[model samples]
Target: MTIKLIAIGKTDDKELVKLIENYQKRLSHYIQFEFEIIPDLKKAKNLSESQQKQKEGDLILGKLNPSDVLILLDENGKQFDSVAFSQYLQKHMNSGIKQLVFVIGGPYGFSEDVYSRANGKLSLSKMTFSHQMIRLFAIEQLYRAFTILRNEPYHHR
Candidate 1:
């Protein structure tokens, strides 16, 4: 199964960009992976928080195919340890899904439309994090999950 991570906005920090890329490269060795970025909306300053989320949601939904299993990274979503996450991934792969899509919403979170369309949600932590940082964290965790699955030394129980 292919894993695709879709996030809104660009990461201006070169260090974060490099680290995210590193993890993405490592992940490719395990399964087909994609990192797609939806450019930040223009004239966002004039829109309210809800309006912004709606516009961002539209863009996000536009990138998905009907067969893609959508998972949203949300604060209220289910939380799992590295090992459990790996098992979750294995379950999806075992189900023979063509593509598993995970999305990181823009500021102010996801719109109702986006939430309704998601198959599930995942939370990295209860603590809040910047979108850029979340990108790196999510990617690293994905890489770590794969390593754990293969019994690599990367994760120590």
Candidate 2:
């Protein structure tokens, strides 16, 4: 199955972007992986929080296809350990999902429409993290999950 990460805005931190790219590159060895960035909305200052989210949600939803499995990276979502996550990915691959899509929403969070569209949600940790940093974390976790699946030493117990 192909795995795609869709996030709002580009990473401004060079170091974080490099790390995210590194994990993304490693992911290509095992699967068709891609990271697509949705540019930040213009004139956000004039928009209300809900308005901004709705606009961002439109962009987010626009990238999705009907057959793609949508998963949101949300704070209140299910949390899985490394091993469980590997199994979660394995299950999806075995289930013949065409594309697995995970989204990291904008600064304020996701729109109601965006949340309702998702098939599942995953939480990396209870602690809050910058949206940019979460992108890198998700990619790295994906890399680690694949390694665990293949019994590679990249993920330690």
lDDT of 2 by residue, 16-125 (tens): 98898889899999999989999989899999999999999999999999999999999999999999999999999999989999999998889999998999999999
Write candidate 1's Cα lDDT for 38-131 as tens digits: 9999999999999999999999999999999999999999999999999999899999889999999998999999999999999999999999
Model 2 TM: 0.98
Error of 2 at 130 (Å): 0.4
User: Model 2, 106: alpha-carbon shift in Å?
Assistant: 0.4
**lDDT of model 2, residue 29:** 99
Q: Which portions of model 1 miss their true places by more than 4 Å?
A: none
Which residue pairs overlap in candidate 2's backbone? Answer: none
Each prediction's TM-score against the native? 0.98, 0.98
Candidate 1 steric clashes: 0
